[model samples]
Every structure is written in structure tokens, then in C-alpha cells.
Target: MKRKSNIKVIRIPIPTPTLLPHTTTNSYLIGNEEESILVDAGYDTEDTRKLLEWEINKHGLARPKRIVLTHAHQDHAPGVRMLIHWMPTILCHEKEEEQVLSAISPWEEITLIEDEDSIKVDGEEIIVMHTPGHTLGHVSLYIPSEQILIVGDNIVAEGTTWIGAPDGDMKDYLQTLQRLRNLKIEKIGPGHGKWVHQPHEHIDFVIQRRLHREQQLLTLLEKHQQITSKELTEIIYQDRIHPSVFPVAQKTIEAHLDKLLKEDLIQYDESKSSYVSPHF
Candidate 1:
């Protein structure tokens, strides 16, 4: 059944799934005066879709007007086709079109959100802010009228976000944090965390924490002189590296090294797996 909030929102927690525990998915049921919309869909699982259907039916929500994915990660988009069967406009950032379109769903449909583009849903404008870093196409949806921001994997209140191995960029992620700071948001819907009631404070914490970590990586690079990106990450992350996140951590470190190299801050010898920072 629909859990009613004064503003017409029902939060449905979808399990993120794994051998270990982490924040549960916090997909949202946002209803306007009459119709409704879903923020992120949990993992691509039969159970997830089934639960979603139950929530929708309970609310007596008309077919959702749209399924807005915060990013294209499979964990968030699997239910797109299933949900759309009810008839909702699917929207994702233009930058993410490559990743989203590449998803290869049986249903071939999606609309790219242009930069500075805002889509009107029942007179409420949900502006798309292009924030790359976690993924090249990652974007957050902001509703200025409500001071609410729907951020997907940008920053999770319960845990640190990953630059994540395999294409997650540290520099871009940092820049995105700065951009979010300008929003002065009051409420947050993180992809995998508890609802954030203290938005600006949390943004500051994430930004400062990332900057401190960046400095730590740079310092370690200089001290070690020559080390592969993997070696560098091991030294920097040390015991904090969990086996689950090690691969992701390695990729993120490499992205940082690449950016540092571009700025003449570090160098890699192709003959070896090591890289050296100018400070060292």
C-alpha cells in the first residue's frame, strides 16, 4: 500500500544485493496531485520489478508518467522496460545516451536529456544537471521549487562513493561535488543511502573528504617514486581497501594518475608498471 507523506512520496527500499551488507536501494514513488513517477529502479531482478508493481498498484497511481534513471548502471536501470510497460516517458542525460542506449534492452526506447534541459512533469520542472565522474554520463535531477535533489551514486550518505574501477574518473567526480554545492539543496535521494535531510552539510563532507584523499594519494606517489597504478593504490588505500572494492579502487587510482600526468605532476615509464610523481 502507498505510505503517504504530506507531499505524496512513498519510498520503497530495494535490496542492492551481494554477499555482504550495504545501504538498500531507495527507489521513490513521487506522486503529484494525481499521477506519479519513479526515481531509480533497484537491481535488474524479477523480485525488484514485482515489488515495484505492488507499490504502484497500492498507490492507485496512474501508469507512471516517466522512469527517470539517475545513471545507467544496471543496478539502477534493469526495471526500465518493465516499468515502462505501464507507459512512462524514459529520460536520461544526453551524455549518458551512449551508456543507456548501449544497455540493449528488448524494448528500444529512451530520450536523451540535453544540457540545461528541464522536463516538465505535471508543471514541476526537473532540471537535469550533467555531472560526470562516477561515470561519463552520470547526472542528477534537481527540483528547485522543492529544494530537492535526486542524486544517483554521486554521494551516498552512508558510505563513500567510488571512482570505481573501469571508467570512473576521480577528477570529474571532484568537479561534480563542487557543482552540487551550488544547488543549496535541502533534501536528497541518494541512489543507495538513507534519505539525506542535511544536504549542504553532506555535500561539504564528501568534497572535503575527497580532497583530503586526493592529497594523500599525491603524497604517497611522491614518496614511493615508481609504482604501478595498482601498487600505488595498495600503498594509498592500505587496509582500508576491501576486497570487494579493490578492483574499483585500482581503476580510480589510475584515473588520478592519468590526470596528474596530464598536468605534468607524474610520469609513467612504459617499460615498467610504475609511475613517478615530480615531487618524488
Candidate 2:
């Protein structure tokens, strides 16, 4: 199931409004003369479909054999239904398939992928990496031959990816970052923003930023005897984020708190209804 060695990936950028700072969601077309597949069709609008068709026609890409979703986020998976008429097999990780199909009508031809599963388009092998954090079932695809990692919200090219609480775990995010850093990636094709030319730097920067944010959060907590997640969010992130995005920022803050609490560096004071630094 590998694509031909000569077929290069074509990135079809589509405009989609999500909570993210970026304006366009990148849908990648991977294929060759024999077969092709699409990754992350985020925009389902008529205009988006037109653009996709235009790109396919412009580049002379064969109709895709399947559509692979990296995650089930609204910004990434919503467009699947629009392309369902194309009759491509919709594929996602087993852990993420349910979430991916939650909003769309069920179809009998869905394939659940797993880590190390290689999806061959033409003849190229696209390897799956189950890198959860931004979402529990989030995944990143690695094309070993091309050394390109298609990082779906796991690593945004510009603004940091928000790790939501409950479903999003900071600990898992950090682990995933580490996992990516260990890879031999040359470039990162993020779901949003520009392509990352140097993945090592991008991955390192992302991980360091998260660690630094945690440190800042810890310092903020230490400054106060006790602070609720809301209070903490107000003091640490409210000013930094727009009012409309404050809610999402709070969820990320809560995720950070969860990590600290798990590490015994912080504790939840049920009586005070606040988070307390163990040092305090």
C-alpha cells in the first residue's frame, strides 16, 4: 500500500474558522499515479470543496483512495462528510474513530489505524504515530522516506496548541512532545500556520515553552497562599488572551494544574476551593 517514490505531497490549504489563531487548515494530498489519500479535510464548505478540487485538478492528482483524519477536533474532522460523496474510505485511529465520527452519519467503510501501521499510497509508506495530548486520540503521520511529519493540532506552526482539560492532559502532551523530539523528522507539516523547516527546533521550542509555562504557573501559585483555577487563569492568562478565548485558556491552565497535582508539586485544597503549591 505504498505510493510511488516520485510522488510528492501536495498541501491544499483551506480557510476554516476554529479557535486557533491561524486562518487556514492544511489538507494534505498524498499519492501518485496508482493511488492517493487525503489527510485532514477541515473545511466542508462548498468553497473549500471547490478549492480542493481545483488543487487536485491543478496538480493532476488522482482521486484519493481514502481520507485520513489525524484527530477528531472540529477544525480537523468536520469536513469528512462533505467528501463522503467521493466514496473514499474514512480512516482514523481506533481510539479516535468514535470521536471522529460523532458528528457525522455512520458509514460502514471506516478503517481504524494503530501506531506503526503503514498506509501505502501508490508505494509510499505513511507511518502512524499515536501522539495524544491536544486530544486523547490525536495522531501524527510520519513519511519515513520524505522525513515529513504531518502534525495535526499536536504541533501548530505558530501559536501554541491549547491542551484542554479533562480530555487534554499536559502530562500526555509533554510526553508526546518528547516522543516527537526523538524522531528523525526533517520537516513538520502542521495542520495550521506555516510548514516547520526544522522540526528539532520547533519540537524543542514547544516542549520548553510548556515547561516554562508550568514554571510560571507554579510561581504564580506560590505567590498566593491559595488560588482557584479561575483565579489562576485570570492572573496568568486572562490578560494574555482575548476575552472570547479566555474560556479555552482556562481549560489549558486546568490541564497544567492537573499535571502539577499528579507530580505532587501542587495540591488541591478542597476547603479553600483553590490550588496550593506544595512549597506553600
Q: Residue-pair clashes per candidate, as listed? A: 2, 10
- Would you estimate the TM-scores of all the predictions? 0.88, 0.94
In the range 8-121, model 2's lDDT, one tens digit per residue, is: 788877888876467788899887656788898876677777887788887888878698889877767778777767887888888887787784455446898888899887
lDDT for each residue of candidate 1 in 53-84, tens digit (9 for 90 to 100): 88878877645777777777777776675565
**Residue clash pairs of candidate 2:** 1-120, 2-120, 2-122, 2-123, 2-124, 3-121, 3-122, 3-123, 3-124, 4-123
Instruction: Give Cα distance to truth, residue 35, candidate 1, Å.
Output: 2.1
Q: Candidate 2: lDDT of 184?
A: 81
lDDT of 2: 0.83
